[model samples]
Target chain A: MLSKKQARAFFLGGTLVTFLIFIGLTIYSFSKGNDQSNHENITESVVRGKKIWESNNCMGCHTLLGEGAYYAPELTKVIDRLNMKYNGQGEEVIKSILMSPVPWQPNGRKMVAYEMTEQEAEDVVEFFRWIGEIDLNGFDRIVSPLAKEDNNN
Target chain B: MKYKSQKVAYWFFALSMLLLVLQLVYGFVMGFARIGFDNLHEFVPFNTARAVHTNLLVVWLLSGFMGAAYYIIPEEAQRELVNVKLAYVQLISLAVVGVVAVVGFHFNYWEGRKFLEIPRPLDFLVVINVLLFLGLILVTLFKGKRRTTTALVLSMGLLFAALLYLPGMLPFDSQVMDSFFRWWVVHLWVEGVWELIMGGILSFLLIKLTGVDREVIEKWLYVIVGLTFLSGVLGTGHHYYYIGVNKIWLIVGGIFSALEPLAFLAMALFAVNMYRKGEKKHPNKLALYWTLGAAIVSFVGAGLLGFAHTLPQTNLYTHGTLVTAMHAHLAFWGAYGMIVLAIISYSLPNMTGRKLYLTPRGRAAFWLSNIGMIGMTVAFGVAGVAQVYLERKFGMDFMLVQKEISIHFVVLIICASVFTTGIIMYIIEFYKHGRPTDEAMEVSIQ
Candidate 1:
């Protein structure tokens, strides 16, 4: 029994309300949540490292923050792995790999040894270090060693 | 064509077909690359191929929608396009921009944003191109004698789609901030505004093909529009989960995105009901097949499969897995892709003065593409589940998990080949239609 005008109004108004809720929630999260607070004191090196990351299109192969291609290992915990397994030689290991450019058959990694400067390699690894420090509360770390430590019941 | 200006649509559709071929070529490149055929890795790496593949999809679909508008707006509005020559200019400029952006990907000169890899400068050009397109469509719709519901819905969708792109262009320093806003462009487009476009185009096709009353069909349009907004607007939160956003999105996104299927379901029901109610049989059974298929398959793909991994707990393991790929391939193929094909199927004969409706080749194209895509979706699903178990749950090496799933890509390539064959046949038939003449619009198909 509703008029077409009524239906259209309900449709448009509902969309408006929903969109506003999204904006409101996202703004609240940014001001009072984990994402913005950690990034408030971003160092230049971390920022430079981010630029290095994008410029090299490392995301084309690697997943960061649980986003990007799944071809390579998730970089969310790369720094943790390096510290625990490589005795904090993560930067040198990553740099060597970038310079050598071959698929490590053991890991089945198909990453190209991207042509990057030594400085750029440092910046990229620095970026990873910055991300590692952020407490994601186990984002993409589901059932991993990190989660196991947190949930040891 | 009803108006001489309508002939311009043929060129846009032609451009769409050409770009579609290029899109498939890149798809094959990535498909082969995935199976360890790294021959083209040096020239067109997997990342570059993916960028090109996705961008080509967006460009070709835009071209198709533009073509549909050029053909539809004038007929719906009962007026010729305000400026035909400028439309040609817009098309040519669109081709130039698309070519430049695609080529830049090879040189690693892209923005590196998935589905938004075009650099900022080219984005500006895209904006201008869309502005020109909207100008033509909106002007034609408003100034004409009639203002149909279908026209308004289609134009609104186009206008909103343009406005949404601005958010993606805004710079964000924080990765969380950037990812948060990025979904506003990505999820909102496919799930929100694009559904509006689908609804509008669906209404038009149903009215024409079913020979049903426009009022009855437009009524369904309102319902579809309502459901799309109700579910899709909040569904943006689905991407917010696990992206360093508030934990609230876990509940908000899961609850909301879970409801997103309702919108697609309504669409399927709407199409089927309208189809059953209509007594008049339109000779263009091919168009009807596409029109109906788009509605039903969209529900299954976007609604059902998207639901499988949309919940927060499930998405935790499947966030960037091949599960997303499975949902993506079918959803995109079913919704926007098939809707564009529907309009092309309907308008081609009208524009070309050729009775190519219900041809055996057309039937084969529709079935093969659908069957092949469904098979590909299954292969991706099997691989995704295995990867989730081996890598995410069992904590195996990422490379080891990928090797375990590599066998699935062999099935994927085979299915994709069948899909490509269908598309090639469709294009060949499109080519056989020759050109549009002014007389075609007056000569209705029997």
Candidate 2:
């Protein structure tokens, strides 16, 4: 039993809301455009590693900074962890791990070979290094690899 | 013995309700565990329970929709369903596949995606079920007395659902390609095909209940189906933006998904207009709630939030967060779940030949469930924004952040518990008030 005036108001209100949403989205999209174009300062090695990552579909197995497949480890913080674990031999240790066939098993985790050339492995290590350097201060927290393993058990 | 389509629909409805109850229990158990993680061992872990919860929701909704279609199509077409045996067979196959898929999750035989977790074997069974369903629907429509607008759109939806699911099941070398096809099945079905079916069913029911003009309802259905497909097919781009797909997905998914709200808005307007112009009064108030609420919720939850994250840029921030979960919970429940409830409310009395009114307790239950849902939506939405702020703005340890966010889990659990109590009350009232004679009247009318 809505009056004509009320119906008109309703329609007008709906139109206003829709227009506001469109405006908000336009502004947001424009802002993100700036962010994407700001990546011109990225290193060549990182760019090469990104290509390799995409070509091999590494995201199908590994996650980078909480994004991608959860089948493998988080590579974003791998550089710092490798540095800490291998006593400052961050890049070399990562390269060796990728090149050398190491069988590491922790229940429910299947061993998969890292099939990459030495130079490709180095490039991936450099990618991780670059990601580690990106200021993640205002980024979503990556899923904890250890916690996921703990859950599986 | 002649097979009655009403009998089949009732049986399927009952079975769907049973599954729904079980799903709710699992949801509650999972919610509780989220609060007290130490209580449940890995034997029935959160991930497994979550897989069961989501998959069950999909299966039960499909079952209910299929049952409704089978019941309504024949009556609207003014003929018997072409193959009653095939309908029964489709039901059995779906039930078997659903059970195996759900059981497989508890046994750790899942593929590990949130909603698409059923293992390969169970997936094959589902594909078979879909094919059989499409075949039955198409054959029935072809052999029926006349083609109504509802029958045509519903049949088209069934056909598209089967076709879309096929590509997703195929093995593809590229994960990006696989992901694209997966969204084609999941997004297209819920947002696209299902909307068509729901619109058809809703229009049919409204025509019967309110004595609205068939022409008006049918026109609304046509517009809804058109909008659903036009916006929804391109809306698949929303998911593609972040998954390493081409950058074009950002523009396509964002702009089109933004337009998706217009469909829901139109649906709302249709309902409101019908109510305004109707010659006959709606017999049940609750049914009116279901009809109008579905339109509002789908508009706000699915349409608005859909726009919110449609932008590849915003999605970069919102993907995988609780914000996504909020959108999903509201949209699916509002659009599909409420529509099904509305359909059942309208048809049940006709099927049973009983004037069913919600008891005071039932009314209370309805309010409780509605309020609980609203609380959960707001709580989860706020929690998601908070998580985004804390995680992105502050370099908090990811695990620590999750633990901190456990507070929201507690709130959601409380809300779900209230909702569960409401559902239980509803079940009790349904048993007390539901009349089989009302259905006898409906059959006589046919």
Candidate 3:
């Protein structure tokens, strides 16, 4: 049985730990900087793809990492998946896949058409290609998608 | 007259349980689809199952809460319900609306949002039903002997629930604006107003079971209510970060939503501390289990995970994944489900005038449910982390990766099966043996 004073002390201790964790996370994220250039050197195509992504409100339909509308698939790893599926001819093949309105039938799940313009498809392909190069190992386990899959399996 | 309110409450409780069982079955089917996906051409597809699960959850919660409010309000106010017949009418209307919403989803007439997918007409009926329920509660308090803090807080919860839905129904030009107020309905109700209801019900149960000092319990209620509004209204900013809102939402949501957990943590501490200090002891062990379980689970689920996703940076990676589901599952069950259980455990004996304690089977069911919940939370939490990695770091095909990674869903389904088994055992126990006797008349004297 915890006394009132002991409970208060425990609470205060928890508050202190929580504050330290918060401060550490904030500082780490700030040090990492919000710039996209640190992980993947930004090319014109990548920048163009980002612009297209914003204009088309791709985030409204699909998530990149985990942040966006849950209506569509996450595009963060689209480049890699396409690369693996097409056997290493990376960007061009990914672009073709995005541009070609093939009726995607994966395990009988009918894929809906995204109706992207040729340029827009290229831009999305470029954006995904950029994400494929980033090193995301240091992020928190809860937010780190890779960490979750490895542990659960 | 007293028996009339009790009977009405019991009947509604039964109906709510029936819905709950249906919800669980649909939820299991949905979980299985996530894992197997062998037959997408089935009558109940994944989308249909998801809609049913979400809608059934909302209906059952409303029904259970209505029953709780109806039963407790009158007793706390020291008189019969002001309009008992209206209470029955409200329940019937709500049932009709619930059936329509669920069946509509089956026929593919859903609005496409997870919990808020009920058609517009059904949503309107639900709102009206809630308002009528609130009005009845208020009138009962007015006409009765006096007011208790529990009754007042519960009434306030009902009022806020109705008030929050209005903004959601308003016609907004921008989809962002529409989503903004939609959170007012969804987030505010679950994280905000629901806490108020939980606090009230928990306090009432504690007082009745343990004979704790009303003043102490009421003071805790006041603190919980204050923390709820203070944190909840501002905490709505958490949902705004990615919804095309201004950048300031990042700072506001991260900071304030972090504070929301403190309220629940404090409530947990308060309850446990009160139990330790109280002079009287509860006769029924299961009732005690509920009170403590509610506090502990709420602390872990609503408080801890809630804090994890509160920050904008974290939300940037954890949004819409299984992590959110983990938090919601535990929080809803801890805050609302446990409160309903506590109320039922307290009242069933009184209503039936029997000394009801959980049999050995009932005790096993309780443990199974707790274990299953923990398993589900852990599995989903890990799965969510995996999703962030594959999608964020590896740049994998989202759909293909999800297919590869749905093993976690299998674990969740297994856990749900374990939980269902527990529920079955509990039902059997309830039918075979009734309540404990000594405490049956404790509430009737008032």
Q: Write the per-residue lDDT of candidate 2 for residues B36-113, one digit (tens) a residue.
A: 543543455555566677888988888878877777777776667777788788899898888888887666566654
Q: What is the DockQ for all candidates, taken in turn?
A: 0.56, 0.06, 0.08
Worst 10 residues of 1 chain A by lDDT: A101-110
Ranking by lDDT: 1, 3, 2
Identify the leading candidate in terms of TM-score: 1
lDDT of 2 by residue, A40-134 (tens): 34577766776565444444345564444322354665766556556878788767656666533223232234456888887777666656544
On lDDT, the leading prediction is: 1
Stretches of candidate 2 exceeding 4 Å from the true structure:
A1-153, B1-3, B433-446
Ten-residue segment with the worst summed lDDT in candidate 3 chain B? B437-446
- Per-residue C-alpha lDDT of model 3 across residues A70-129, encoded as one tens digit per residue: 434655555544455567665776566556676344554533344567887786676676
Candidate 1 regions off by >4 Å? A33-37, A101-109, A150-153
Fnat per predicted structure, each in turn: 0.49, 0.00, 0.06
Model 3 Cα lDDT, one tens digit per residue, B1-446: 24346556766776777887899988787676566553642466555666677678877877888888888888888787777788889988988888887787666565554467676677788778888888888988998898887888888887877887786776543334445567778988998888888888888877876678887777777776666666766677788665444455577667779889988988899888888888786677787788778988888988997887778887776776667777878887788777776676666666656546666786887788778878888777877788767765575656666776688888888888888887777666555544333334444432
lDDT score at residue B360, model 2, on the 0-100 scale: 74
Q: Please give the range of 10 consecutive residues that has the lowest summed lDDT in model 2 chain B.
A: B437-446
- lDDT by residue for model 1 (A24-97), tens: 88777777443533686567877887876776666676778778877677887686665566887767887776
Instruction: Give lDDT per model, in order.
Output: 0.84, 0.66, 0.69
Report the Cα lDDT for residue B411, model 1. Answer: 96
